[model samples]
Target: MSESEQLMVVDSTGQPLYPATRKKIHQEGLWHETFHCFVINHEEGHVILQQRAKQKKDFPGLIDITAAGHLLAGETPRDGIRELEEEIGLVRQFEQLFPLGVFLEELILGDLKDRERVHLFLTDESMPLERYVLQTEEVSRLIALPFSEFARLTDETAETFQTADQEIIHRDQFVPHPSAYFRRVNEGIQAYRVQQT
Candidate 1:
């Protein structure tokens, strides 16, 4: 399995554990931390979304937010920004992102147990899709959808969004708009709007 396929365990405060014991540690709930990126195209008023590869251990073939990963031990949320570069070749400083706050999310999907204290952030400007170098086994395809349309679809009943090649799925089962994940994003968007005024 690739880095994306590997499981990472962190303490409740988001500290990474030794690689060998991570799987079992995660089960024990010693630590937990996840980073979610909502990359938006402010100029276009759209958000970049990725279609996870069918081979993913969880939520395979689902459309998800722009980028996400676990914050390794001893790493700050800003360090996660660096992980994004490792996963997708994005290189930027912390100032470019707007901290959207954090939320605790717990879910049981199939046999896997997920308990994450997720850190959310938003960037209205992101590197172009064409410039992205995807970790293919992890990501099958990418799409730039209007933010307003995403809000609309969340209200609709579509299953998920599939990529042009059909190798990746971009629908709700993988990532839902009304979900806690989206709720935080909405909060960030609202906060951003407030700051603008």
Candidate 2:
């Protein structure tokens, strides 16, 4: 995504204020909108995670949600469904997405200040690893982690995960979202699994 791309800015209540360039919004600490989707496979008891491409402008090489992106100026939460297909090559209908909740998050690091109203969604879908045609500029690879193990790592209830490539030591590999945010995401996954059963 271009830093010059236009985005819808909003207030604390999520009421749209006006349009602003992505760069300006981040620079000014203006609240903007983002979409976060977590892909879960309850039957297999796993969740998908994507490794961001090293060339990404922000958070490069970090392991993040299954798919996520900023909502353009005229986009709604439903419109954000395209991100799943664009980022990870998962074409999904808007109805397949289950709304978790909207969360306001702020992060500041040196000159970068990000404030976003995150539209979170959960989807229970499983596909073969080869099915994902990753956009090399945005994503490097994808992995599946046991849902129970993910929850434990997020809560610091467990520390290490052995994957085919290498051993993952939670904090050393994953993106640094606040512990509560991870807890909320884990709970959302659990709740969705319960509803399915």
Candidate 3:
């Protein structure tokens, strides 16, 4: 995680532009690709979330996607499977994942302008929480929250998120992706559930 990432930069329309360092991409607001995977257990009504390590530069100590990483310069969305094992010690095959389509998000954190085409996927995991190994440099811990509750995460009236450990959190405790990002992910999860039944 200490090494600089070489990212494949692209235009807003997804046309290849050039390769650049992760720092350059953020500093210049250049569009880049990222891989996002959400692990869910539909029968148990839960989805896994990762708590970021306190030492992270961006969004430290926040709850975020179960497994995610920026795609390297020559990596495909399929290559993102490595993040599952790297971050959470869960090995997966590309064929075992569900496609959730690419999503676009633009954000500015102080002088950092982040633009990304997020390639999303979903995988089902129903294992006991303690069985998973976490890479402490990137993740603090993992939690499974009811999918029904997660759907209401961005609601104005939903003022708090109570974790499995009984720790209470506010909307700000989540990695600050736009509300649209959460909304679309919620819709995608719902649609996926419908297809399974």
Candidate 4:
């Protein structure tokens, strides 16, 4: 199988085990490592989110992280920077990203055991939404919302997010990631926002 069709299965602690087809991993709920990056626009008090292409096999049309993907066999988390370029047409140095620590996210999407040891990261990029050259095959568009507005979704205080452009995004539109993952992501961006200021 191709890189997109296969994943590097890892133990719960994120140590590599072996290569497995993405199907098997999902079927078995096996632990796998994934790289997730969140783009922070501190100047605008916004966090960028990607709208997954409707063609996506999983979570079609859902709002997701800025850039993210599975770590194929023989790949390390650092190499995940490629996802940014491939998905959003943004070139970045690995060092430009701030580590938010590894997190475990578990979800059952109709028998798809989406268990991931997420290598989470945050990067401050104050670019305009129009600057992103989205790969329409993976991402339909980019949305930027203020940090507090996005936080309300995870904290379950709000049902929707209004983008900087004034577009309305319902909470259910986001991928059903575990609450802990969203919490950590929020905290990471908040701290980085302060530093950038």
What is residue 123's positional error in candidate 2, in angstroms? 0.8
TM-score of 3: 0.94
Model 3 residue pairs with clashes: none
Residue pairs clashing in model 2 are: none
Candidate 2 per-residue C-alpha lDDT over 34-147 given as tens digits, one digit per residue, 9 for 90 to 100: 999998877778888899999988888988889999999989999899889999889999998988899888888778899989999999886766688899999999888777
For each candidate, give its TM-score against the true structure: 0.76, 0.93, 0.94, 0.95
Instruction: Score each candidate by Cα lDDT.
Output: 0.67, 0.85, 0.87, 0.88
Candidate 2: residue 156 lDDT (0-100):
59
RMSD (Cα, Å) for all candidates, in order, is 4.4, 1.7, 1.5, 1.5
**Global Cα lDDT for candidate 1:** 0.67
Best by lDDT: 4
Candidate 3 per-residue C-alpha lDDT over 99-197 given as tens digits, one digit per residue, 9 for 90 to 100: 888899898989779999999888887787889999999999998878767888857568687665566778888888877787878887888889898
- Candidate 4: segments with Cα more than 4 A from true spot: 1-4
The 10 consecutive residues of candidate 1 with the worst lDDT sum are: 161-170
Residue lDDT tens for model 1, 87-176: 566777888889987777776555546677788888766467788888888788778766655554544465554332343343544554
Q: Candidate 3 vs candidate 4: which has greater TM-score?
A: 4
Instruction: Report residue 129 deviation for candidate 3 (angstroms).
Output: 1.2
Model 1, position 174, has a per-residue lDDT of 55
List of clashing residue pairs for candidate 4: none
lDDT of 3 at 83: 97
